[model samples]
Target: MRSRGCAEFSIPCPVDLRKYLSESEKCGICNLTSNYICRFSMKKNEPFEETLGKTAAQMSSQKENRNCLKGPLVLDFLFAVLPYSAAKKLFDKKFSIPVVSFTNLGVLDWRRLDFGNGKINDAYLATAVKHPPSFQVSVSTFGGRCALCSSLYATEKNRRVAERFLDGMIQELESAVSPSSHKAPAKSQNNAGGGSSAQRQPAGQQEGSDSKGERADARDKGKSKSKPKRKKTVHQK
Candidate 1:
């Protein structure tokens, strides 16, 4: 089968991207290639040292880089590249954290460097050509595919894990764009009930109409009292 980029560059659905970046999105491009980046802030109440240590441990564990780096910084770096969907998948599957080191470039390094020199060379070339500080993983293609499962799917358990990751990633995208926002309104099951729009009224206007009626009634009552028909005085002339 033909490779991913060479054969055809399928555009990723925006919903899928949303599943990847939940709250915010940041993308950096170089040489016409782009990579998304996002950052999440730390809780303010914790001491710097405590927060730092916890973050360091998490990043080292998640990214699988042993060197002690500050948590917020590590999170920022991760936030930029690994979407919540991918990050959640990696954690759920118990895969080692992947690091982004420019020297290593666009290569997916999961602690042990099992991928050979040629693969490494290809990874480096891909990164250099693309110039995004992060690596992109595609389920279907090599290099672009998962680093852990590409080989581990020999057993049923591993296959299940792989499927979960792929499925979760897709679900993430699907959930990102709300159905109401992206999809056309469907024919209602209760079409006789006058469809979706008929059942709901705008809250502000609904209240305004009631208030207006009350004001008009008050005005009518005041006018009736103030202009009580002057007793048609039988002219006593």
Candidate 2:
């Protein structure tokens, strides 16, 4: 059983979503591809949202289940169809919305998800810049604990602000859930978000690190299991 008052306690969650697009142009829409969003919200939370909010979430998942992508794709099409001025107007209007986009990824038994190797312990969803909002809040539950990870893609000043905001939210959540167990760790920043090279390291760094580490670990295991060679003494006649 989990400790009584430590249910809400959690290690600090860190994410750096600011990725300057220098050569994303390979995809044609690279310049405009900055607007990235993740499926952070869960299916059950759909009912808690307001009118348009709930409808968008439900429709997207429902269409996805039906082998259709039209529901969410329409939003992209709308942006594409709008004139430059109209698009800018829309952006300006949305800029007034909350600086952070919050959503939950539902509960996942990540402990059961394995890649023929070690199982996954925890996971978080982070996305790149999309329009005015520079931050996105993602919630996920694993091993019976809820984790909130937020990503930020903005200028240095804005990045600090967003980071502090996330830290505050984490504290608030912990406090609300279990006041006695409220002990927040200091936050650390690693360019590596979610341990993905695409997110943290350079193109090849992630693979390189993982491969080297795995090889080293395997060598250690092999050494530990191998029996020491016995030396046979030859009798001199």
> Which candidate has the highest lDDT of all?
2
Give lDDT tens digits, candidate 1, residues 1-237.
111112221221101222234355536332222222212244544333444364345444534432222333455566579999876675557523232321212334423344454212111112111112222223221233211112221344433443344333333333332333232134321111111111111112222223211211221344432211000000000
Superposed by TM-score, candidate 1 places the C-alpha of residue 22 at a distance from the truth, in angstroms, of 37
Q: Model 2, 1-237: lDDT tens per residue?
A: 121222221121122222322555344433231222323323332222232353356446543442223323554676789987887687676534334455555666543464678534334344433333545556665443444444443455654555555555544444434455434445543211222111122112322224312211221344433211111010110
- Global CA lDDT computed for model 1: 0.28
lDDT of 2: 0.39
Worst 10 residues of 1 by lDDT: 228-237
The alpha-carbon deviation from the true structure for residue 167 of candidate 1, after best TM-score superposition, in angstroms, is 0.8
